[model samples]
Target: MKNKTGRYSAYIRPFSYFIDLAIINLFAILLLSENVYSIYFVVFSSLSWVIIALNVEFYEVYRYTKIIAIGNKILKQFALFTIICFAYFGIFSNHSNARETLIYTLLTLLVVAFAKIFIYYFLRKYRRLSGLNYRKVVLLGSAKQVKQLASFFNDNPDYGYHLIKIFSTDIDKKLAIEMCCEFTEKEEIDEVYCSLFDLSNLQVNELVNFAEDNNKIIKFLPDNKNYFARNLKVDYYGYIPILSLHKTILHDPLTKLFKRAFDIFFALITIIFLLSWLTPLLAILIKLESKGPVFFKQGRPGIDEKEFFCYKFRSMRINATTEKEASKNDPRVTKIGKFIRKTSLDEMPQFLNVLIGDMSVVGPRPHLWSQNKVYGNKIKKYMVRHFVKPGITGLAQVRGYRGEIETDVDMVNRIKYDVYYIKNWSIILDLKIIFLTVFNIFKGEEKAY
Candidate 1:
């Protein structure tokens, strides 16, 4: 729990998965390949395993995960895997005998299940004995649930949660919250536990912002009076329920991999087929009307509030107020810039940003640093938009919330759409947004400029 190498604990689950996959494929080649193509079986079985595992969250075992939960996951995975194995034979028209196939699957699952449970209990024993893979956590508030949680952490060392301190807000709430933030910053606290019944909306927001900004996990200890929102994930540590902010779909490794692969493919096609020739053509037009760079690059806040330079075709003249948003018939915009911006051509350069991993094809548009600063504090959950990569075209843009935030309401609506997109993201939704974006560009949006 106190090992310096404990920071690498995040890789352990993925490593276990790799080992399991190896065992599966090896068993397939050895036992199930007599009458079938070994390579085909290996490929099909491997893909099936990964897909089923992800669906069942087979590798999400945690320190507090019950043995019964692990068994449940194993059973679910094995059941689905068995079905896929039979379906594989039917689809490929292989004549492998049913009894032989069943035996091979049963053997493979037995070995895989053994490895899974071994790693799970081994980590528990390792943490309890050596104190190696532990998380340093701090508690906030003085609610009854908070006290129970603190006791739970103290009583269960095998869970690997080392309680650093408890900052009780009973005496002086404001000062205690401030001191807790300072202590968290100074110490190596991995997680913050806030009791929902003891803190106000403002205090909870402050704690959430501090935790997110510093890359620490923040969880809420909900009281019976509080409603359990759909956006919060509920986990049980013994009989006590802990609520965590639900992570978006993009947080899943498989989902991220698929989205990234799609982004690269889309960006490559756009660059090769369109941007290859269009860049120089727009370059001349931009240069003829403006005495500045052909491409405009500005720092924008991306995922996790990290700053990155976003690229666009230069649509405005050299100006002192480059950070300011453009207005209707603004003198700063060049003739070519007007056309390009109106036609959504200026954003074409961001395909390179997508290719380089700075952005996505469809997401919340990256905001100027100035806009983030202005709206971040004024609007609740404004910074939540940064939870995912900014995009070239987004749901908000297609919904007529793009360009020139004329009022705070415009940004509020945009944030609503952005959060919706993040919470309910899918490949079909992304493709739909892309289609709408193209249609918007051709049909001309009212706020295009």
Candidate 2:
């Protein structure tokens, strides 16, 4: 079910990286050989270029990336790199000439930028003329926007998206969707372009699940009314805009690494400083109050809808209604449960879940598997929250969507916030949610029963 790429296409970026490094070091040695510490300059410049490139996403140029975007990246990388080069000499007290350093930086960046632009256009021309490196894409829906998108794909072969088939939703909707999925699976389709206006919410959900399960890329053609939807990356094919479902900043490998590192660090601190002693005290209270274990583990879906046992302090006495959410004055709540739930102390044990890598320190809070099944069918895009690891505390919880869901509106609003958080996630946003959560714990939320 894996999507296939051209034989040498995958190596292009890595080759570009190697070539850029060579250019940088070669220029440094050639232009700054007068300095005794030329080797240091080479290493410093090489590392700086890579780090800067990652931050600026310099190598993220794709077939869909515009020339203007490439130029912008080049200018950004050059500016930042120029700063790094000058700072190195200032810090190390190297006697390299200022003019020579400027020349080296300029020549190195020019060559790298030229190589990047050349590859970008070369791929475009190659795809158009040689008919290689093209993705086998299926278009679904019969909306006007979808028609325009199909036309764009047909007109611009240089973009490397081969329009395999178009399944019109104007006919029998269910049959069309089924046929689309079947064809996609049979043909080894690389991507599916769906029009939001043509498909129902449930149908869209099914497509999303199918794409996830089958390892196919799914994008949406947002209608004119919903063009400004949040949490999706919009890519322009000429004047037409297409929305990508999984293009969030979190989708970046480096970004995921940073978030995972942060999660581990934060989980360890909480476990060592808070939970280590707190768990023993909490366990004694729970045992005295009830006859069951101190910790309660409930099956919940994590990232990709995979089942994992979510950990929490035993907040409820052993009851037949463990799957049911606790209301304001539910009979299942133990005396200790009331206090822990109010103070948000019951969720502290989930640091273990975070440490174990089944969850995150900050993300959409995992719900009961039963609740997920119900709401996932009831609400549109409700399951999108599972795209990231469920969290102990989340944007929805901090925004007062925590605890019992009394109405469908409550869950709908919660899903909105969850989607927004996923789309707009940043390290700073995670910190803000943590801060707001702490504030809510003390200030007392009305629904934190």
Candidate 3:
């Protein structure tokens, strides 16, 4: 099996989806242009499918390649797409060309469903039979453990572990030589899975050097399976391999979706009901004491490092944006600014940012673009915080890592909490943070500033 064949087979899943969406989209315009919004409609729907599908491990090529399984996948994708499709349709249901009945839309959905299944399976079979796919892989651990693994491999041939040979990292060179001899002189193997735990701290560096010095691929079979799965991201493009500790949204998609939806809904409620009254009151107070705008808008980075304007009540004296960050007992803060800073009323307008998807009701708070520039240069992996949308309030804030950062220790700890939130993100965790925030808001603290 050649690298090209293996690469094509690995890519078939995503390719099938691209073709399927392309076909359904083409059919929508050709067949139902009168009622359906076909052009931008297809664009949004397809993009969502691609991102969400990839997130959900839909493209991961495991051993299962049955037609029944493929059919199930098509059905699942259609069901999810239907949810997106209906949401879009409902938003514009009042449009002149909207579908008359949900039933008609569902029928067309079924047609697209079958079309996708056909394309997916056709590609799978073609790749399985014709694609010269050779997966570069190594079995980890020693002869005993690998023999156990080999037994497992014998059971699951479709796994495609191209076992090259066994490599051992025994503390005693005599043991290593004997074991390597047994495996080489006796059994068939492709590559080795090394156990660093077998080596002393001093020898660990040498073993790593030896493995790196060789061109052979190395697989580390750590004792902790869950830890390995959680930490390792191994991506291979043909013979090229890359590893990283990256996150996929599928690990917690429902939570992420719920968080965003709640942000929008709560933000909408704030603007529609509370803002009308509060804004006027705040506006009068702000205008009486300050020459600046009633609402201050500043650019901040959001999810995936996209920039968005964040809104807040005018808390400080005019032209205070560039001079310094807001601080406790700062003379630059106006009477209204001082009160709002303590009470956190200044942050209310950011709810609008939540509604518009620029921020969340609860996430790591976005820093000033200037602050981001300052800290990002100083801190390692600081920008990973922007992997999700910034928020109105966050665990760091509620946990008292808020207000002025007087030291590097504070900023580092703040980032630590932020990354912790991102990695362990869940609806339950978010709900806890929201509850804590409301508790802090009413209980009130000087640090709220």
Candidate 4:
């Protein structure tokens, strides 16, 4: 049942984690004492936990599972965690951390690890007692796909999804046979998942109508291998049906919160600390170079095709306009602008853009209205890039796509990288991009005239 797994499923793991973390942190404090080595132990333990847990993918939580599976997985992951702990510390330890302290920490961590499992076991049992049932549903997919879905349902109990039938066909004759074969005259199906691939428009319509007639919730999970969705999963739950398709990965709530929060937090810090101090000096330089506003502003297409005034330091002569593209050796770029563009100091004003919540610290760099004009018509899925707020630096920028949009192919490839970044946005990925950006700023930075 969605009711049981909805909030409780999330809380269970986080609760288990906090309990384990508290136990480990408290033990480290008590036993390791006021030593820098204690920090190492905590870090080692945390790293070990994530590494082992991540490899097992239990945290993904896509289905319900049995107690045996949960208990066994916890055991396996915790064992891996402990092994990594010993091996990591063994290689890196100095003379101070005696075998006694190490043994105590290990014993303490083992208690915490088993506690995590025991806690889950208790919670699962309590939940079962509470009648926390999975959402009863039926599958409408190919044989292979339906079997895989059924197996997944059977395997992962935490998911809280119970597949009641494998309705592998979507045809009317076959559908009737399936209905007759799988369900008796009195049976009611709560949900009909149409995971069948390569269905014609007529077949899709028929299946949709059938689900609607039965008052059954229908969910379509397209094959991941076929990436073309024409922006399939965007548009705010289909209330506003537009010609364009949206990339769904960017709209995932955690990914959205993470990317936006990173943009806002780092943007504010930069605005207050770095940009605040740097702006005045840059303004003075720009004013001296030419008689124009120190900061440049232009309307850029943002998320959902919304328009916002993007900011940047004026990196060209006053006569340079928004419609003009930046050239490698443009005459409009001032002597100081040349230096700034080469060093990427010009993009410093985008910290304000970042703070305004119009851009990211690192993402698919926003394009001007005119460039979007040129490429939006030319590139397929070009408009989907607006699914999320654009960034100042992105996968494209670091991977040598920043400078000039020389060709349609260049923009296409650039969009490919942007889509890749959009699909794979994470805190760790952002951190890696930021690190790479810093490295590039100092090591072979591209000249953005």
Candidate 5:
């Protein structure tokens, strides 16, 4: 009694990747010369892309994730593909045309990236709006987490889970068991999500046996106490298993190295190409407009709540009193300051902060020391953003959560985006934020003062 529609679930992603790479190789052959080594190039590139993508679980769609997350996974897989191509061409190949080979690789990757984006969004919308394909799912047992899961399924039809029935402790135990068995026996339910915290071992065994006998998938929902354990990896040491949540993706050694490399590369380009002329010009403007230093250097919290000097082009008249947060049409903003702040050119000097390793090009933006203390006490998990170095522009800023915290709702929403950024850190996400930031600057965000 195998499931009919999802039977080929495992093959879908691999098949797509295979087709994409095949097209890329065919194009490369038609565009470039058809050398004897072309076959080897296709084989190596396809294998590398598939292997790396599988290792990263890049194709496994998480039901709760956003489309941006899917795009992030695609870009990360392509990044790995680019690396493998580099290794093959630079280290192993005897060809003198390494640059040309890299160019072909880049073009292929770009094509596949666009293809993945279309497939991901288009298929999701088709499935949701057309109501074409959906998995029949049932909930078992009772817990707060179970309700949360149910709410999520109801809210996101794009996830393709159709809830049929819920059997919980509120119902008679015997009747609940009977209904569960009946559901499985009829082959009406494709999967069962059971919360085991309150269930007896016998009850759990009964549910498991019924699911196995009916060829239905079973997933266990952790207790509400473990709600915060979203992204932790489980590991086994010999026979004993361990649940560890201390490490996050951004804190991984390889991830840190890769992000640091990107930060340096981006910072160097900005400094040499754009900032070299812009900084001197802005410095003179600030000097002529205001009676303070060219740069406003203030202490702000960085990773792990450590203090760092955050630099920005001075965008306000020197205030001897308490530095209150900027308001709409604040008189403290100088003429030059208003233009720089509105254009976000004031944040340009933070590239120096990025270059010096005090900050990143993208992460949670650091707040002033006073604001940090105030928000730390007011908001839950406010300090979690400190897990990674602060950035010049961040998820919250690009998402239009920047500027003065007019109310508690603003602060809370800002923290929510910050926490999300920390949990879902990726190079592609960083690049997306940077792209949005540029667009926002040009469009002129309403909050910009």
Candidate 6:
């Protein structure tokens, strides 16, 4: 594909990297007060930059790329590079000053981050002022979606896509393909977006072949009814592409690592400090109040709909209508059960579940096995919540969607928040939910039983 940000503007990212690297090395030399420039430092810096380039694709910053996202990617690259540098210095260097090296890393990171933000804003302003850096794109097909996409391009100048041609599939497919090919060949068409719902298999293959022959970028936006499906993920098994219905942010290795680390750390603290002493006390209290086991174990849908024994302090009386959910002022809940439930102290045992890897510290709360079956059938995307491990508390619970499911709307809205949490999962968001959960415990939730 032709350069979307104009040919000359393409060098900006590479040039910025080169300048940033020189500045970092200069700072290192000044800070270290080294007699000779260490070859180890030079070689490591070069190789680390290469690794960062491969990992981040730093030059692939498109017009639609958010400034915050760009800054984040730069920060990630810097973090990785800093880790390698620290390891190198820690393991090998006798004279390495940890404090100085730390200061150098922070300074370089700040410089890079500031440079990236400044450059991004500069480019955006330049594009808006000059009306340049726009890619000439062609749309094939007259589907309603095609028009909607064109509207988006027209509306968002920052997207940098300018539709120069629209070929309606209402006309002959062969002629449309030929015209598209000719235009791509004659003009600087950066991309061809095909939404040809009416095109046959052979015709679609022909269009793809023509784009390949001309070395033009072609993207297929399937006009299938499920195109607007929630949390759609495309996975490639060798050559075949499989469309997954739902996937969560935890699917990312980094996210999984961070969440798992947090889960383990938090669970360990709770289990060791609180549960170690509180368990016996709670067990005694529960035993005195109820005739059943101290802990309530139930089969609930966990990650991937795998049944796992979810553990909680047994709040209700033994065999108290297992099929029926406890409600406010329910007799099934013992006198002590009501207090523990209201304060969310009954859920303390789930920390063990978190430590054991059956649950996360923060995620969609698990539903009862039978409730999962019933709601999974009634609600459209109910089971999608199980894509991630069930949590002690979740976005839904923090947003007052917890407690008994009273209506179909209640379940649907709960699932909606679950999906939202899955899609937009972040460490900050998880912490916010945890904070809110704690806050709710203090302020009290009306739905808490």
TM-scores of all candidate predictions against the true structure: 0.70, 0.58, 0.55, 0.49, 0.49, 0.52
Clashing pairs in 3: 6-133, 140-193, 141-193, 163-190, 164-189, 164-190, 164-191, 165-189, 165-190, 165-191
Model 1 spans with C-alpha error above 4 angstroms:
1-23, 38-43, 98-107, 110-136, 143-145, 151-164, 172-191, 196-218, 222-233, 245-300, 306-340, 352-358, 369-374, 404-410, 423-432, 443-449
RMSD of each: 5.9, 8.3, 12.1, 12.3, 18.1, 16.5
Off by over 4 Å in 5: 1-243, 321-323
lDDT of 4 by residue, 141-224 (tens): 577645665676566454455667666554553564347324621354545655536355566566654543333445555655
State the TM-score for model 3: 0.55
Residues 386-417, model 2: lDDT tens digits: 77889999999999899999999999999889
Model 6, C-alpha of 195: deviation from truth (Å): 13
Candidate 4: stretches off by over 4 Å: 1-247
Per-candidate Cα lDDT values, in order, are 0.85, 0.85, 0.63, 0.65, 0.74, 0.76
Listed per model in order, the count of residue pairs whose N, CA or C atoms clash below 3 Å is: 2, 0, 10, 15, 0, 0
Candidate 3: residue 64 lDDT (0-100): 35
What RMSD does model 6 have? 16.5
Give the TM-score ranking, best first. Answer: 1, 2, 3, 6, 5, 4
Which digits, one per residue and each the tens of the lDDT, describe model 3 over residues 141-164? 455544555554445444444455
On lDDT, the stronger of 4 and 5 is: 5
Q: Scored by Cα lDDT, where does model 5 land?
A: 0.74
The candidate scoring highest on TM-score is 1
State, as a TM-score between 0 and 1, how close model 1 is to the true structure. Answer: 0.70
Local error of candidate 3 at residue 191 (angstroms): 27
